[model samples]
Target: MPDTLYDALIARVRSSTKARVVVEAAALTGGLIDRGLIRSVVDLDRGEVDAIFDELTRGRVLQAVGKNRWRFHHELLREVAAELSPPSVQRRLHIRIADALVAGAADGTPEWPQVAHHYEKAQRFDEAASAYQKASINARQRGALIESQNHLARALENVERLPASHARDLHEVDIRLERGFLSSTATGHASAEAAAEFERCLQLISDEPGLALYATFSGLWSYYATRGDLRRATQLVEALRLRLADMPDWYRAATDAVFGSLAVFRGEFDSARAILEAAALAVESLDSAEIEGAWFAPNDPVAGMYTFVGFTRFIQGDLAGAEESFTKMERRCQTLPFPHGPFTLCYGHTIESLIRTEAGQTDRAAQLLGDVAAIGQQAGFDEWVMIAASAGANTSSRSPVAGGARDPAALEEHIQNLTVVVEAWRAAELISFLCWYDAALAQTLLAAGRKEEARDRVDLALQMAQETDWHIYDAELLRIRAQTHDCADAVEADLRAALELARRQGALVFELRAAADAFRWGGEPHRAELLAVLDRFPAGQDWPDLARLRSLVG
Candidate 1:
């Protein structure tokens, strides 16, 4: 036999009875020499254990680190000693050690890595998978996202070793759902990998509609929403509604929350408000027992419901209501165990920054946008960074009438930044965001007094909006078109079209803007029309657009 320290240790353990017992016990307990444990294992007194340690230390096999603590001089020696036992004996030892560790763990939650190792050594694949899964959950709770992902992969590897069955399929789907959620949280965008995982889950859960509904809400919705495929998202919503009466309480609540968000994206503020309110109430009423067995109930749909409602209220010129809803969303996210699930805090902050910018809190808006921009950049989320940059551009480009002087250099910088954002969106094929960014760019150009360039930008934005059927920004684009026109009749025609579209879409903020523009260009008759519309909204006196309109009228 080849001579090595490990070989020598093994040979010594095999030759001496005391050395064999001490080495076997040490190997069983993961190579740590517990003196009292050794005495108990070998049935030796304390003095005998000290004699055994002295002999092992003199032979360069064990080293004394502290009182009652000793370890093999080389870990490889311990491994070799562990292998000296027969295969059957080794497995039984692994089981015994694993049981002891489980019994000693606090709250029945063992140190997962050690538990996983022992279970694997004992050839218990299913138990190892469960241990790894627990490890992943523990890592996630500690905010070690990447480590959690690795643990999940290990769990899946063990899961694949199990025989095929309904339970096995369900376990696989659950793992995939968690993987998808984690992927989205880490990158701040829905990944194709996550979409594939969700698709796999759907295939596996075809017969279980309740689980399928959860998969659709958690996976399909995220995929279509992030891609800006509003038509597909709408179709999915319709399909879910067809089965609404059959869905469980949690599923119904989540579906309505998603539907409300889609409605907000489509500029159907009235429908969004009603649907979101129902969703919020439904989710709030869910009991812990009802959701105990859910595989992917990490996100509180109620928080998302409030967020969409807040966004809708902001667009409808209900600033106070929007602030209240956003505050609720913020508080809910803060209280959640894993708050950065579906809708992240950065997303909430972005909307809040936009509201502040519109409410004349430019400094506060800038600070909020800066915070999100840093977070986005750190996460490598281009879309989030782009949102922050776009909002920053808008905040920086405030005109003299808005209490800030226009800087030509700042306007040009905004155009450049927005150009980059537009190109990035185009590359991603995010048509909705691309069109909105185009409109934002045109607004910057208009503020810079570059009428011809502004007209070109707005025209492109309108064309893209039409091509994609993304009418959410149609009113805003039409208003910009009105500003680009030199002729009074062309300006009036565009303003009237904008006002009608905004009114039909329930976009009160855009309608107010169009009405103000109509009064500025169409003279006495248009002014009369503006006052008539303003007369219906007495509570809007504090709104930025309405406040400006009142000053102009006076």
Candidate 2:
């Protein structure tokens, strides 16, 4: 438990974001503790609540019309107070108690029935629903499927009583859907139920302009990014960006941190760098009240926003920056629930692996990628599926597992993994990552003696890249096409197009690979010119860039 009333309030507010408003309600209910509005009441000493109220105003969790009267923030609490009905205190009480139970705290365990009594008194059905859902999870863990289903149905009943506009109703549904999805663990459906439920929330949010929208948007971003849909993911981000136009600097900074990975995946590296750089500067804002307030903060999912910023740093090839980000992420995860999920663990290891790989730590990189492969082999088809196959797919694919002196199984395997992601993305209709993946996979396959398969993959890669007008990928696709036809001098056009794009983007690896390929096919002047340029570059064991990749063709 937190030490002070302010700390408790902050923790509450941070968990649900809506709790920020609930904090005001909690105080109002406390106006007369004799009133049953505040239940399972714990003593926080006299003046502690008053101190919290004072900080509430100063913190601007809500605003005041006059000194005596106060309300929650207009953007959050105000609308939520009117249109969005919260679950009953009794119901929320049960959920909290269950959370305590999950945390292994026995003190709150015996209090569930009391919370249920209050819930029945207030007729707060939705909180009852959440409580039931929690009960279901607990029941299922104890191998009580019948009890779990009964609790789940009761939870659904709470959702039924409210109108579509009631955020509590919608939130309950989200909880139920997430729970159901996890329970079913759908193997064949690609977790479409989860994705579809998320989509529903996304649609509903367009009609609401309060805290629900923020919550919905955050969840949607995470869903789309994890599911590999960058275009929609981009829209979610831009929506957040537009919403933050006049928002406080703190919230804006937080949003940037959460969305950093989406931008990185979208290949907007410089833009990602800018967003993360700004977020990296926000760590100074942490304090005890604020830390406790993580529960109240809106749109602060992916705790240790800085941890994600560190990931962006990793993506951008900054080892020191990545280390800093990972450190914050590790700390923040300690405070949040199940901090290391498949997503976080996979990301952590991959980033560490890349850093080690780039720093000439082959043994370390091998250990990291090797571990990733082992864990990922069983996780089934989803994001990890894509990641497991794509590691070192580009540069090291041609080398054997440990980089054979002159063999190409490693490269072939990389291409195979790339093909897997390509097929998945094409099926998922995610064109951007799909295009890049296809182009790289084609090159890998071609180098590995799988010429026929390479041709088809290359054609698709070029088509998608051309369609998107992603010039970086487009050039690589073209050079590939030219090479396939043995177009000789015609290859220069493709290499030049790719070279110009790579130069502008600082895609050093891509540039080298394309030029190297051009030299191999076009020969003479092209070969001599590309080598001269390559010599000017510093030698720190560059990954198999385009220049190196092209050499594999010979």
Candidate 3:
């Protein structure tokens, strides 16, 4: 019945070829047409075109949206009218309409989606891909990362349909690189999906030297680093150094930041501090606008570089230095582009909060946690949300362990929730902080007096750290491991090892922590050793670890 009614409408316009042209124009352009678009495609004068549209509207086939525009009264009528034209004619009309729209773009920026749509319908894949890419960029500028990704996906899909050639391969590489960056921003740098995109780009990116290096560093090196594979990460750093040596000063600085982070992961605190500080200084000398275009990573390079510097300082017990670095990092975040800016801020806040909590500055920690949660929620970053929630679990007042409140069931529930979240992160390949999370979980378990479970968790964390050569948290983990053992001999051996490792790493904070744990566990036997580590801190500093150590000895 719908088809019969549509055919009657079409038959009414059949006597006038120009009127038929108007129906096809309305049908082809998404069931809507203005006088300009109709006049562009048809030979009728503007007045005649207006008359035809008015007649169509009066006949109930088209509805007037305004004085100059008309649309099909029903979608079914538009579909039937669109099909009335032969495929060849339809393709021609699509191209003509697309070209007219491009010509009519008053602001010089064509409506990319509409232009791409018409070109795609015309089987003009090249134009379609380019327009789609523009659309993707427009979406990205608006902070709609997911929408940007969809547009890029469409661009890639359309570009792939074109014949295979070197140019096509390069085009695909460009699209994939953009997609990889978006994936890294939306999910995580170490996510499997982001890795896959860069891996594919690496295969096709040989001709583009800059892009090849980016793919290798961002894809392969990042994957290994996050998964605790520091050996591979070191290898990649060496490769990056040689490739980057002659490039430029900025490249050298970027490489320094990368190597510095690797050093931090390996527990080489002193060297990591120097390298990261030098990199930060180099970046700090540049204007934000200069860094924005030159620094070639998904996130703000300076912010990330400073974050590692902050960690290095914190571990080395340079509390003031660490706070300064974190403040700098947060300040850098404000100038960054969308998604990257927010993500970097969230990440910096989360890590800073962890440090604050450890320093026993609960009020500052709470404020940072609030910042992290707000940024994560505003940016629609699920991983950030999970990470912030997980970080807060142990510190929340209801938890029996880290929190002052002692509800065993509440602590157990927080532990269970944290386990699920961290494991989910593991499943997603967001393993950059897996060891830290595991150790934290173990500490909470020990506080709850579940020694066996604590030991089990500590063992797994240690294994992961050893396997990946990620030793930044080894001293703390060892301290926790020592607590889990019931045998005095075993506990003494672990504590001694933890102290030695912390001292060698120049990780004064960890050394103090291990010393406190030792003094508490070994009583009088460990008192002298604990006092020696305590003297390393400046007198009268309000570090929670120091206060705890003082109370124990006095």
Candidate 4:
């Protein structure tokens, strides 16, 4: 009684009441205190509760925060009291409270963090691990990616407590995979942390080759692709193909989708399209259950395949086809249940806006880009926000939207904003996106008649693209160069080079645009070949590239 508040609180909880009563009250109160809530102890026997409350209040250990609610005057008082309880007694109380809170809940879902805390305190590590994993999922759904990652780390810590067993290993692998996926999504590219997790998963699941393949395809390839390690990504693709000889249809389909995505990054458009088309068909054939387990859930692999398909078609001047593919992806994503976190959704909207802009749907494109900016900002998706801003700026400079025509001053402001974002990406070592935005900025500068600055920007972009093997925009960069160069002969040479690169990459849209430029620069022999390329596209006449081609050819 004469001791300080902490000592007195601990001694009182330990000696005043039966262990059951003390531990129960401590457990319930500890949880409430952690949540910054104060509660009245009405559930305990009225006489006992009154006596305990009065005793604590008299000692100045508990204080009334509200009319009928009381809390420990200081958090240390509650912590000390909880620590002083017998370990077994504390564990049992934790379990009892966890059960009560988990059951009879208002919502059917458990409060994962609270449940995880109780399970961990009770030393029920397996349950703790599961609860933490669920908490991570919930956090991810709410766009709390760093919180999700922290939960996964705690889950893995609990996983380490279990005795060695196949089930334990599987749990560890699952947690690592989820962590890897979350890290990749949060960063807009694979991080070394994600790669390490995926590598650990591969090692853990070595006996299960199918699961190993899943790990490799789900994360490793993306890491290599994002890092510009095309050779390693190609090796992974080949390994997956070899393994596919014996894998199930769903697995093969998912693997093919991943391979298709890799090929898209490699600028192998024809091969990418073929593989993705097969993947799309395979996904369509899947039954409900197979589809559920086929890809990493919540971020569907089939939806990703459609994203690549749409992007590939967009680059090929098949605007209508690209629109169809993007619409399909959006529809598939809509079917996912709550907490539909950003995955390809932001990218889809960003690119779709670009397509809309090029097709002269300026107002609609502006609205979609606005959505992209908003979603990216809310979700902490910096890469998508940068991409959306770059695309939006370019679109605004070229054509009027709901806003009036962008004057020279507005265009310069957009360029300056884009420069800041691009530099930030560069500083962050987001190499692929940096290169992409450099090209975009170059195009914007060219459009604004800043030929010297545009030339310098495009050259830098081309250098980065070649250094990184990110040739997806190679032809476009060359075309931008053609626009910025002063000499007619230099422009002709640049356009011809662009045409060749576009043809090699099967970027038909770039090819048409370059050929149109060549014809415009008085390279008369390009006329017949340009018409033939334009004729191959069944639609997209309204697209800027095709429209320019048609005008020149006519």
Best-performing candidate as measured by TM-score: 1
Instruction: Tell me the deviation in Å of residue 285 in model 4.
Output: 2.2
lDDT of 3 at 229: 75
* Model 1 lDDT tens row, 1-554: 23566666866777788777667767766756667555644556788677878888877788888888888888877777787788787776666666666776669887887778777788877788778888888887776778888988987888898899988888888787778766766654546777777778878877466655566455566567667677777787777677767656787776788788878777677788888877777777785234423434234555667777777777776778887887888787676554253235567777677667666667877998898888676654555687787767666654332554356675787778777877766776666445566776777777777788888888877776665456677888899888888898888888989999888888877787788888787677778777766665637437554577777678
- Indicate the residue-level lDDT of 523 in model 2: 67
**Every model: Cα RMSD to truth:** 4.0, 15.8, 3.9, 5.6
Per-residue lDDT value at 272 in model 2: 63
What's model 2's TM-score?
A: 0.59
Error of 3 at 167 (Å): 1.5
Off by over 4 Å in 3: 1-26, 37-62, 73-77, 80-89, 106-110, 140-146, 245-249, 287-298, 397-430, 486-489, 519-535, 538-541, 550-554
The 10-residue segment with the lowest total lDDT in model 4 = 33-42
Give the better candidate number (1 or 2) by lDDT.
1
Per-residue accuracy of model 2 over 330-356 as CA lDDT, tens digit each: 565445322123334555565565445
- Mark the 10 consecutive residues where model 1 has the least summed lDDT: 288-297
**Winner by TM-score between candidate 3 and candidate 1:** 1
TM-score of each: 0.86, 0.59, 0.84, 0.78
Best by lDDT: 3
